[model samples]
Target: MRCEICGKKLVEEPLKIKVDGSIMFTCKECSKFGKIQREAPKPQRPGVSRSSRVTKRIQRPREPTEEVIENYRDIVRQAREKKEWSREELAEKIYEKASVIGRIESGKMVPDLKLAKKIEKLLNVVLIEKTDNDIRDEMGQSKLKGSTIGDIARIKRN
Candidate 1:
């Protein structure tokens, strides 16, 4: 075993201890980090075999849900003015910088999904529209089969 804090290989038995509420085994030298735990909670077992432990989970690729509207700047500016709020007031409401709000309203910077949603809620606007129903399938060729990350990273010395 190795020390969790220092990563040094321990020649002796690792000290069984707890950090916070979590139980951990650390080397003797690194045991001073947390208070020694008297008894760690054990998992309930009913004598199941190791072969039953292996299980697989299926994961589907995530579909894009939202897209920013074309005239986002005009929409945001109009909505903020409708509420009679200054750039600083709007930024404080949304937890963002006043300069960022100005840039967003002036069409200099496009807001990401999270910020856009917050703005939409505060200003009562539809800055983004859901696009999960209409999937775009314009992807071209797939990658080659056999190449690995290590293969590309190896230096070619002549």
Candidate 2:
């Protein structure tokens, strides 16, 4: 280990010191500038290796996410019309402004999951769908690996 303050190589055990509210591993000579602190021993889990923990995380499956449907505008508009509710009435029911409802109906805005859920419960319509996390290429092949920084750099160069 090296000294934090003096930047000199430490032959002996480094001292833990608290300087200006920050703890640092410093050499014995520079330790006089700060209050000496006892080093706390790290707790180890029984029979749990770091490699095993990493492998377990890598083997875990990705969870599906909720996404708004493509024709949400038409579905919401039709549901509202069937209930004989105006844009202002629907907006008031959802605690949102009439402009928000108008924008959603006109395809100028897409409702988030929270808003979609509220509208679905109030209008009794499906506006959100669960989608898998798998990404596909143009040829419909699953892309398990993500693009690295080197790949992005090559693309930019091209």
Candidate 3:
């Protein structure tokens, strides 16, 4: 290729172009003279990237426990602080009374299963069911004869 303008070697730029609705290759200098429009590279279809094949590990659900409860409270408190929410505002999100949330945080009550689950969901943390007793006696149906109703009632009432 030679430069049409200066007769210099028009290094092999091999410009594919369109001229008068036709396509061909020419030197850059000639391209400028002809006002030839260069063909734009075809847009490539995006491939399935290797990253797409990489699978993320599924996180196992954590067992709920006392530690989970404390951690959950801490997390909720932190989020509430970051969001600039009063305890009342946070309570609104969970449809709970702020005082109840306060009681939970202060460890004044062990949340029952349902309340614990609700708290866990609202706080985005696990806060219950970590320890499980498997022994049959734990179910309170032991073969051994248990104490009398009055004794049991007295014990329970206390």
Estimate, for each residue in 100-148, the C-alpha lDDT of model 1 and write its tens digit: 9999989999999899989878876667764543233433211111121
Candidate closest to the true structure, highest lDDT: 2
Query: What ranges in model 3 sit over 4 Å off?
Result: 1-72, 133-158
lDDT for every model? Answer: 0.66, 0.75, 0.52
- Per-residue alpha-carbon lDDT of candidate 3 for residues 1-158, written as tens digits (9 for 90 to 100): 65444556756775655667555566775665455643443324344333222321112223322333434455445545656778888778778899977876666755666777675566544454333223335445233113323322432343
Candidate 3 global TM-score:
0.34
lDDT of 1 at 117: 88
Q: Each candidate's root-mean-square deviation in Å?
A: 17.8, 14.2, 19.0
lDDT order of candidates, best first?
2, 1, 3
Better of 2 and 3 by TM-score: 2
TM-score of every model? 0.44, 0.46, 0.34
lDDT of 3 at 25: 63
lDDT of 1 at 146: 16
TM-score of 2: 0.46
Instruction: Go through the candidates in order and give the clash count of each.
Output: 0, 0, 1
